[model samples]
Target: MKNKPNQLKYLKYQKNRNKGFSCRRNFLIFGNYGLKSINSGFLNFKQIEAARKTLVHNLGKNNKILIRIFPDKVLTKKPLEVRMGKGKGAIHDWVAVIKPGIIIFEVKYKDYDIIKKAFFCASQKLSIKTEICYE
Candidate 1:
């Protein structure tokens, strides 16, 4: 994928500014670190909602899964209201906080990069291992 000129410049600046900055921070996966494949809403609600349910219902072989529902878009760190769907529905880019003792699995249909960032970010913050499970 071609990089946007402005985004490229900003990334370059960040790279130069933080020489000692390590990619590991407790274990926070910054999903918005890079460009996304189209947008979250671009995908069909049915498909997205199905994926969300699969994440929660499947859970893990042993680890407990906790799904966070956001009311609106959250681009950065800030206390915000998140909405959880009743049955089968989409959680608009919801940030699922996989608590301690639970290995987080970030599931994505197409956005590998976004999933990776989220996985990494979660890993950094939660001090737990995070894995990317692509659908």
Candidate 2:
């Protein structure tokens, strides 16, 4: 079955900069490579899962990959031909409201080249722009 969130507390949010790079107290505390978001947008769980799968499949089990963001915010939608007067919509999917400078993924390994290759595959799965950062 396709992945879907079982429940969500709310449907809409304030779209404020409530979280960002400043909140990550240990952004570089564990990884050598960080996947930083260059744009702000909602990232679906499926997209993150696909990117993570690509990283693990290419990098194998020796290295460690950490997913920093999560798809917690609920995004609702209506049917294609539905009437316009309905109340908002039902919960259709879940996503993470990513902001600029937020680290989406962190990779830790000894080989920089391998890290770059793995990140390259993963980066293609995202919709918004991203940048590779190292420490």
What is the C-alpha lDDT profile of model 1 across 1-135, one tens digit per residue? 111222322221211221232222223243222211211121222333444445444333343333322222211322355555433333233222222222223332345554454445443433223344332
TM-score of each: 0.23, 0.82
lDDT of 2 by residue, 24-68 (tens): 523565788888887778889889999999999988977788888
Question: Which pairs of residues clash in candidate 2, taking residues 3 or more apart in a chain or in different chains?
Answer: none
CA-lDDT, candidates in order? 0.31, 0.79
| Model 1 misplaced stretches (Cα beyond 4 Å) | 1-109
- Winning candidate number (TM-score): 2
Please count the clashing residue pairs in each candidate, in the order shown: 19, 0
